[model samples]
Target: MFHSVCQVPTAKVCGDGKPSRRGRSFIYRLKDEDQVPQQVCKLFFLSTLGYHPTNDSLVLSVMGKDISTPLAPPKDQRGRHAPANKLDQKPLHEHIESFHPSVSHYRREHAPWRRYLPSDISMKLMYADYIEKDNKCSYESYRKAVKSLNISFTQLGEEQCESCLLQEQHVKADHQGEAAVNCPQCEKWQIHKDSATGSRLHYQSDAERDLPEDTSTRSVDLQKVIMLSRMPGVKSAVFTRRIVAYHETFVSVGKKTNKKNTISVVWHEGIAGRSAAEITSAYAAALEKERDIKHIVYWVDNCSSQNKNWCLFSSLVSIVNSQTISTEDITLKFFHPGHTFMSADSFHHGVEQEMKSRPGGVVFGCSRIV
Candidate 1:
């Protein structure tokens, strides 16, 4: 069978009566004894030997080696020939770490470890600043390094100070330095920052202050409206209108015991609107649970339609003068505008994380959100 498929042609004799070695070549027959094509026969023969006919390089490499020698182990070429322009990881990491000094931590007790940069700062701007200092890295590399640090650009639902934002815009618009130097907006921005800092300090002090047995401090905030029937990564969900749910959270810290209590009131739009009346009612219900406390210090944001309205004030007044409750004095303190970071906000963040972590990343109804 072998002689029928392959034949070594007779070599021409050289002048010295020796057969020429180069002319003795094997001539393959296109058809075997069964009239099968040589190509199909070659494929079947390779399969029997556990080799793929399509892998020409591997087949040729194996054929070129001596039968007595074993195949050498494969070599991993990764990272062996790096580009000359590859950046040194040390300086790139250092540049990214330098931004940590400007990063701010969340004031919420539950999420105190969460850090964020200013809203105006972004990876593009950070990369620009880095390159200005003669850093040798691409913008993509800088952005990846920054993301690996687990820092966010801003907290969810964070509001920037209007005065500071306006001042920055004014400074950028001004061509000459004289206008920005004596700008009233700049002065107002300074005052606004100072007030915000002071109010934040006061809130912390009150939250941590040791008080009498009957006194307590609490912070309240309404979370951003959550849309139900949430199906993350579903293209169809984008255009569809979803049910809106409201969540109002109150985080109370006891003065003597330092124990923290969290209360969440959730409702859909079909049940009640997020008007001042509904907010007041929900807060009043939370207050009813803490009737044993005589003096309550309430910290809240300055939303006119909710916490700062006359309806909520009236409700609080009625609670203070109630015959059954032990609440005599209720001091309502408002955080500085655009700087209202409260413990209640942390509860909302937790709820958001929970919703995202659901199986299939889908929430079918409002009840599932609760």
Candidate 2:
């Protein structure tokens, strides 16, 4: 009977390894009273895109050979006692165990994805599941059971970050509305044909005209760092300190830090350094020891006073002309007004988290850790 059901076109594996609409007959030779397992029937039916079979339905089907003898009915339609078999004599637990194959080993084999989940997140999931189960299982009990099983989970779950969520929403909105899509620039430096043609009107060297000849490689190495906006003010008792942080995220390739990588800070009495001189003073002090760097490009927001003024530019120019250090050129790249999120933002977030964890929500005044 099982062989009869598998006569569909999908039951055959085609030469191209795809399901073809070519019907094929399946014949299974069996001796008298021989039985076929339920797993075989399930795998066979599911292969043909058929619905999965339940245990009760499969047991009562005429197609399957029953493993156990006929069980006596507790009460027939006429209330007569039916003949009993050895299968009816066992307990309810035994019957359930026989009907459902043990999935303990299978579940164990498939639980590797849980390792990427942090313990706290796993505990939260377990707690939620326990609550949803009407509090039948305690969290402590479930935790103990999991610990006894000796499972190791070390990876993070597939959760979206705020930036990713925002990007998704932006894409969806751009599609739905008439707003122009802010597509990511494919090339770092793109020179339009009109701009290039205009620049050729005057006979000048590409270097003299300040036109980028080779966008791929301008110097020996092009390492871009970040200089973020002023972070949250840290307050303690009577004194509040402003925190300025910097991060060299692209200094080395393939090396990543899970924590904040910020350095070189100035702690003023107020929230932050507002004046251009104070900001440049802190910046100069931070670069006092560094001498081997070739090009220092600071990606900062378009702030007029603190970072973008002539004072800061003149300070950098004077430092380059002094020849007191090995640094050659300094460039300040201003980010767009509303879209200036960088590694510095993440670093500031880490700092805020650390500060919140502290007593009285206070981070003491200090310079950026080297």
Candidate 3:
């Protein structure tokens, strides 16, 4: 029997090429110019490089205009101008990518572990040099060195401890043998509080005592926080005290400064922390004088009397005006809690160490002042 034969097409025109032609054939438009070719190859455009189109040699066709230029934004005459930068909010993303080092060569260390002491830098360098990347043995060596140096946990190098003997000597010599009043908690019996008669009363407790007694020792310490309140260009300090006796201490502390002229007001051993008018009068007198003292920072702790006693505040105000000081020039501020012992000041530290020498001083004195 004779059968009709049909020809099979070639593989190149299958059409799964650029832009997904999917086997489409084109008819010449309107047979315009009747001279058109009978068969036409399709043109495809692909964006990604280094990839093949299904049929490698696709024909090129002319396409339309520019695509990159962005359209202008819509006008919003009624809308307000762009909000300020401070008003912008951060964008939110679903997830984050992060990388961790395969080896932890730089381990965390506690700063101020031993009070910033001055000590050998050799062990630090030695451990740093030997620590190998991703090597357990190197880490073990570092641990061993840390234990050997006894400085592994404490970042202190044994040189910067403010309570060191060398530091104390330097402070005393610098102050011309006049020492600071150490924090009462650390200074032991040397911490003195004046009774109503203005006499010295020492309180004692070893400032060196610390927690975990058997394994480590906490050296006793003291910190003095200086407070000041200033207005505009002028500054004045207000000494702080918990009780009335603090006024006496404040006056005494002032006496410790280099005094070229004598203070007009006399010290009243019998009556202290009272007589607001008298205190104001004294401040006014100081303001009237033209001393070399420029800006003053008077540190004062929280006292109800400061607000309760109208006379004292009034006195301060008058003094500010008389000293050519503006009311807003002075500012008053407090110190952080429990940091008084760490202060580098002389009185705060001295008071702590001296109490170590005095016996039975803590029996009658308080342990919070420095």
Candidate 4:
């Protein structure tokens, strides 16, 4: 017989619609699978605070009038064979019906403040458990845990872009021990990204061109369509400061044709031209060192960034699908309005919001779908 304050409280509803039968004679036993026989028929009387949601725990209670029965452990240590009057607990799989919880129906939180969901937190917990099991509680272990947990490091949450699982790995590898380098504005412990503006593509122009054009066709992957939106608000025209902004685009290419892909592009009105070819050309031109000139098909929304097609298919980006160009190329498409690009394009939202946010009290909200 056991009762403790940490156990689930049993409140009997009286005729007057009030809780009654308050008592203190309670006991508790550790929730041990092997100790079931010794713990049954245990009387646990939880004291005050039992009815509160935050105080609930898994604890079995027995009453004075309840009858008792002998029990025996199961041969497999998974179920009790002698509790014939009541079936003992079944295996966890028995309760789960074909459950593969991760990556399915994921709780996608696009909030700039919160990028993770409950399952992601649980996965990190499990990953921590994994670390403890392997006796590898190193910084690298924690970094991997952040990835498996699918969340940013608690401290680096402010650096939303670098907090990505992949980017964390990169930073860890390329930390280079924070040498003292003269920055334009200021210097800090780590090699500040803004100061360094590290080489995105390493150039090997000195090397001979060994690869052929036909063989240069690399695998292009198409990813999920990404959506970008911001919280609505009003503004005034009495500000003295000028406004500045940055625009960006995210491209998701299919691993190969016949597969689906996604691209999330959020750009300013003037910075990223309102043309499909120009936007992609900007990307290709910027990534020339790492990317080869290739034909690209972009299927985006009927927004101004893309020209509106006045045919059976009205979407400007849809014209790519109806094109007659014959070449081994990559195809990118926008995810549905609300979906976000996957692991590939991490900071698409932040880039979009930074650009479209109110500038110099002039409304720059691209609310019009056209």
Across 95-149, the per-residue lDDT of candidate 2 in tens digits comes to 2223222222112224533322343545556556545745444556555545444
List candidate 2 segments past 4 Å from native.
Answer: 1-261, 270-273, 360-370
- Which candidate would rank higher by TM-score, 3 or 4? 4
lDDT per model vs. reference: 0.70, 0.41, 0.30, 0.33
Candidate 4: misplaced stretches above 4 Å?
Answer: 1-239, 244-246, 251-304, 307-330, 337-345, 349-370
* Residue pairs clashing, model 1: none
Give residue 93's lDDT in candidate 2 (0 to 100): 27
Off by over 4 Å in 3: 1-269, 273-290, 306-310, 323-329, 336-349, 352-370
TM-score for each model: 0.58, 0.36, 0.22, 0.23
Alpha carbon RMSD to native, model 4: 26.2
Worst 10 residues of 2 by lDDT: 214-223
Cα lDDT of model 1 by residue, 129-196, tens digit: 88998777877888777777666675555565676567667777873433344667777777887898
Instruction: Indicate the TM-score of model 1.
Output: 0.58
Better of 1 and 3 by lDDT: 1
- Residue range 1-370, candidate 4, lDDT tens digits: 2332222335577688997785323334434567553332232222332444333243323333222432223247656455645422232222211223222111233434323433234534544554455543444544453454344322112122222343345445655423334632223323343322221111111112243332222211112222222223423333323232333333322333322222233344345443456444433432332233245444333233432333312332333343432334444433232222232333343333444564323232223111
Distance (Å) between predicted and true CA of 88, model 1?
A: 7.4
Error of 1 at 227 (Å): 1.4
Candidate 3 C-alpha lDDT tens digits along 76-132: 786476755422111100000011111111111123322221224344444444343
